[model samples]
Target: IYKHSGELVAKHAFRVASGLDSMVLGETQILGQLKSAVRTAELAGTLGPKLRQLFDASFSVAKFVRTETDVGAHSVSLAAASVKVGERIFGSLSNVNVLFVGAGEMNRICAEYFVSYGIQNISCSNRTLSRAKDLAETLSGDYFPLSDVAHKLEKFDIVLSCTGSPIPVLGKRAIEKAIEARRHKPILLIDLAVPRDIELEASELEDVFLYTVDDLGEIVNDGMRNREGAAREAEKIIVERLVQFKSQLDRKKRIPVIKKFRKRGELIVQIELEKALSSIAKGERPEEVVKVLSRAISNKFMDEPSRALNNDSTGEKLSLSEALERLYGLNKN
Candidate 1:
């Protein structure tokens, strides 16, 4: 429902790709996510010419944002944030039994963060049991099928989920049952899925603290004061790049107009040359024929402008006259 000029729309995309407008200031995850989105659109054949150009330029801007600035110095990621939440809630993670759902890149990253804290109990649950086994083996933890997650939910103190499921895997009632079975022990659940692996209503349950992708970013941004200067510097780079891209876009927009104008001039030249050739063939003087050709071409060029000035019904005709005078130097005499 929103309408914006191409330049303004591109400006927003450029800022977002640079992580300047991210919920988590200078977070690196969004760039990967944007790349994935573009790839998906490409596969689906929905990536139009302008959109493809926008994303391609955006990726370049993101690269400059990272290399040209110190914004990447403070890498407070959602995985780290999830670990922070566990530490805050449990006071100690060495004994906290962790359950990771969907062994994707996000889960692997979060598992590594938890491992860094010296937590030993980590389990992986995924639809592909083999994938779960691979991640669990890497993390030196146990593995289970995702189908068993709901039944075994009460066994873990913390659960981190990121899946490509079309529907919510953990419903509100299931969470309530798990909380009841755990005897009111609090559970920290983080869902980093696009369609949400956990139910939205599950967040309302007691003894359950649920944080989504956006929630993690908002929480992480609160502690990102160190990156503010780097963010400003990155913005300067984006502005410079945007101006260059805008100039390119402006030139592209003028192509059709320039082509049409040239076409009209060529047509006028062709008509006059044909008449001049016919007059010469009928034994007219070559110099007189050339003179007629030049005058006819001049008049043809001026015909539209002369009619526009004479009609002058619009109040803005003065501006049109000014433009004509400026373009042709009609006042030179």
Candidate 2:
């Protein structure tokens, strides 16, 4: 419910979407979260032009930072770190089988990253069949019900679980059985849920490497420290963006003044041209008509500024020529 105005909101949104404020510095998942939140606000009728503009600028800033800086080039998120750990163990993921235990946002992101690592066989199991199927279809993987996880566990060499169950989804016994079924082949288990998805005792099992959210903290912190330079560069970009956006807004505010001035000038030109044309039609000299039209337009254009300069009611020391020079950025040299 925090409210901000002017550049404050813009700055905050830019930092957040660029991942400067995230635990994993430059993790791209926050950008999607921000976009989703913006879309939700739009559907709820709470998004306005200013907010939309700020978010649009934020998206651009995030993309620019990622492209220009190495902010997102390193493994930052727990999900990505998990994939890295898996790659370190298996040397490559193309031949390994991966199982994602939930179809939530975090799992979705993790699945996408794993697929990018060339994982050919990926499966998803969730409490809801439809959600699991949707995520599986998106990743070109198989979907199964949560109840089938135990039976299918042995087939996966890597298991990433982030379900919201209050109790542990896979205990030591379940993992032990899976290990026995695999003939003691090694398995990499990553539990990313807050309350813990895999049982704590599962870490003690042979041929199993179990890692939890706490285990990923060191990696996340290291990533943050490594990206400090890139983060500074991103901050500079945000500052420049703020100044640019403000300049654009200022120009937008002056548009009406410009339009009004142009309209008035057009009207004056129309009146002067008609007068000159009538004078010529009435047999006046063409040269005289041309001279009168030029002088009349120039006089009309200067009249308001001349009067204002003469009045000098604002107590400023600017002379007529100086005022005109300042207004138009004219140089005497």
| Sliding window of 10 residues with minimal summed lDDT for model 1 | 218-227
**Clashes per candidate, residues 3 or more apart or on different chains:** 0, 0
| Candidate 1, lDDT over the whole model | 0.89
Writing each residue's lDDT as its tens digit, candidate 1 over 1-333 gives: 556686878888888888888776887768989999999999999999989988999999999889988786664778777877887788888898999999899899889878876989999999999999999999999999999999999999999999989998899988899999999999999999998999988888888999899999876675476688788888889889999989888898999999999999999999999999999999999999999999999999999988998888676688889989998898998
Q: Give each model's whole-structure lDDT.
A: 0.89, 0.89
Q: Largest TM-score belongs to which candidate?
A: 2
lDDT per residue (tens digit) for residues 191-294 in model 2: 99989999999989999999888888788777767788789898999899889888877898899999999999999999999999999999999999999999
